[model samples]
Target: MAEREREPAGWQLEQSAPEAYERYLVPPMFAPWAERLIDATDFERDDRVLDVGCGTGIVARRITDRPGGVGTVVGLDINEKMLEVAETAAAKSQLEIEWRRGDVTDLPFSDGAFDVVLCQQALQFVTDPSAAFREMRRVLGPGGRVAASVWRPLEYNSGYVELAEALERHVGDDAETMMRSPFPEWTGEDLGTLVRDAGFSESLRTIEIGSMRYPSVEEFVRREAASSPLSEPLGNIEPDVREALIEEVRNALEDYIDDEGIVFPMESHLLTAQR
Candidate 1:
């Protein structure tokens, strides 16, 4: 007997994971939060900073290279392939960020090993966020801070909303099935509750990062498509549907575009709590 094939229930597409995440995803989608994270965090030169689920070491490098040099910047991620890309980028940029392969929910760091813990856009994929938060809290020193940033509701982020609209038109209402992509969704209040539940005795505040615009609709699409998990499913879509979807996205951005190109706003919420 032959083995059974897995059935597609959700966003079952094999998505594209490209090196350009550092280039594209960083600018519009990620830059806002990265900057907010930097602002919210207070790191001394000798402080040890741990970046959880550090994708391509973007946040790690940012904290390490702040105004003063950090004592140690370590990035931990479950995906070695992502770490490989991160290491390559670090090496190319001449940054000495330590990239480690590990699970965020069960961090391997010693107790009170870090002065600051940062988790950016990583909580969504976590199977257990409370456990992940506890792990992050466990690694923080006394008076240390734990800061995390995650996507607001899809309705809050115009870029993602536009993408979803485009997908819905092409794949019909079923396109939302693609919404189950790797990107996790956690509200601002949810982030605060998680931090408090993890034993952080602190107040939580939601800070609006900012918005970004792409040069053109195609530019936005390429950036989104190249990095989107939905890209694979979109590619598998009949060419007619794919083209139609692209057109729908283009149409959605008409009100937001200028001579510079298509402009869309992306928003994120930052949650900070003390240990």
Candidate 2:
């Protein structure tokens, strides 16, 4: 798994977790949102951009690969392994992305350094998501735009709901809550409130729910289980317990497999605003 639990003791990804995550989790869990988040904004080629909380650089690569002059792009993530993976991808693609290992709460750049800031599905993992938004606003240039997305509450997230249910049954409530607690406890209106609290004016707030199709059921369970915060619980127990948990999740996920593949409804909330 590419996820490493963040240190000083918080729910973050482990260093070894990135490779597994990029291969298994990114395709179905995040790839669609990368396209969707970028589509939410009308970014100019020459506009300087920064992707906060970029995991494995999916959004960064897209920004750099955008036709025309998508301008300088920087990716910041607290996970070093994730940054290493991002840098490796940048080298392989020959895209000039400035990837840095840093926290979303405290950006390392000077104030007003970027014209556009994007965070794709990274807000919920932060200790203080609102503070992270404030940092995005802080480093943003005058009239800059910020686009970020968060999974709507756990209840609305089909994939996570199924996974979490299995986890609670196996790992008990403490670990289950620890991992799922990062999900925003409110709605799109609550998301808007956070944006406004960060001194940004919201232009759009929408919940995008769509079906995600994985190539196979095994890959879906492998990737989804590996990347989930629940992975820690599965990892701590004996191999048999972990396998049992995986099997339970796999059987539950079977409801999603179809003629095309493992298709299931997934949802995320997008927030686009200006600072």
Candidate 3:
């Protein structure tokens, strides 16, 4: 594979991985931050909310169930594959959320079109987060609020740390680096810098840490290996070797397993700013 193509794969998608993303990764990885990010927003009954770089409408769907009636909640993403799954999910749940195909750097909406914007764990995956932040500011009405989160770092995100360690023990450092790429630029000051560079007011950057629980190690391994962009690196290895590494990782997680499932820690830096 080309070097550029060798980067981690979640932001973009393969043909059939969307369902896996929603089924396997949403609860353990994205939903905690999604719930907290939405709660941190100053949403009103009739405010228009936009979730940029929304994956599977996790945050947008939750907005519909918030206290009062919201005017409009739109989920915008660059990947149609993701949008398709998100749309299917909304239909299945009988929720009304507008899912659109658009880039965050140049949002396909009029100026000052939304009253609030939320992005969760997506900024680091973008090639140009500064431009995306500016577009976020541009799309917001006066007194509009923005709340977003990015994974703090691999060391603080226990599940990924152990996963990366297992991959390094087998696949080498290239894969390890790709696995760890989603968490740079996540410090409170670093997050504040993002909004500052985008020409927005200083943000209140705080850390929101949560624990993720999975039913079992087997389920976690199956979903992660089958669904993530990290799967690409494993494709170059022998089946036996790959399975061995999965088993190794699963065994390592036995320490965190409880009756509820395997519990692991996760941390994200939540940044709330104004337009």
Candidate 4:
């Protein structure tokens, strides 16, 4: 395997994973997707909104920034570190958002507490998606709606597939599993059934296609590693092993690289349901 001379500077900073996620992944990936998910639903001015699993509070912040503003936006995530980042970001933006550390399966809110519940790229990680859906429905008011987005499958997200395969080869199976966990193998029908079983009445599912770009393949691997559970594992590996992993990803994703950087198509299932 080919190796680079040195690992990129600051690659071993595992303590800043959440901050890295907000700074790196949110702009290129989550923030744009959050706009799409928010566009799919109708949010009236002053409508109470809850963003479930709101990493760094991008969706919550966006909703509050919307033209007429919203009513009582709350951002909830199980990871306190992520919530800390979310709080900091919201504070920086001078946006008033409640950051709550709570589990998705059992939300900490009263019944009919929100008019709109928005979840972006989080349902797949839930141990019990059905329970999470139930909680979403339980907290929504009469005629309220829930909007959530989940990556379609690994096959549809080519960039991540290559990255996961490279991690399996160089890092370990656990690393590959961690990388691929975001893109579940659930179909649109499967997601609809999940919401329906959770007592949501009217449901709509759509496929949203988008692109993710990185300055280079190395940056791609480095930023993704820095932002996720793979941070410590990748940082702990031998420097040469890390270089080889990046080389593998570069070779695999060559077709997607251009003058700008590495760019690849991604797909997700956007589901909206009413309670």
All candidates' TM-scores?
0.87, 0.86, 0.87, 0.95
Superposing every Cα of model 1 onto the true structure, what RMSD results? Answer: 8.2
**Candidate 4 ranges beyond 4 A from true positions:** 1-10
Better of 1 and 3 by lDDT: 3
Top model by TM-score, which number?
4
After the best TM-score superposition of candidate 2, give how far the Cα of residue 159 lies from its true spot, in angstroms.
2.6
Model 3 residue runs over 4 Å out of place are 1-15, 172-174, 235-237, 251-254, 259-261
Candidate with maximal lDDT: 4
* lDDT comparing candidate 2 with the true structure: 0.78
How many clashes in each candidate? 2, 14, 0, 0
TM-score of 1: 0.87
Q: Each model's C-alpha lDDT?
A: 0.74, 0.78, 0.80, 0.91
Write down the RMSD of all candidates, one decimal each. Answer: 8.2, 6.1, 6.8, 3.2
Candidate order by decreasing lDDT: 4, 3, 2, 1
TM-score for candidate 4: 0.95
Ten consecutive residues with minimal summed lDDT in candidate 2?
2-11
> Tens digits of per-residue lDDT for model 1 on 153-239?
676667668777776766756556555343356666777788888899995677574677766665565555556554555546665
Error of 2 at 24 (Å): 1.0
TM-score of 2: 0.86
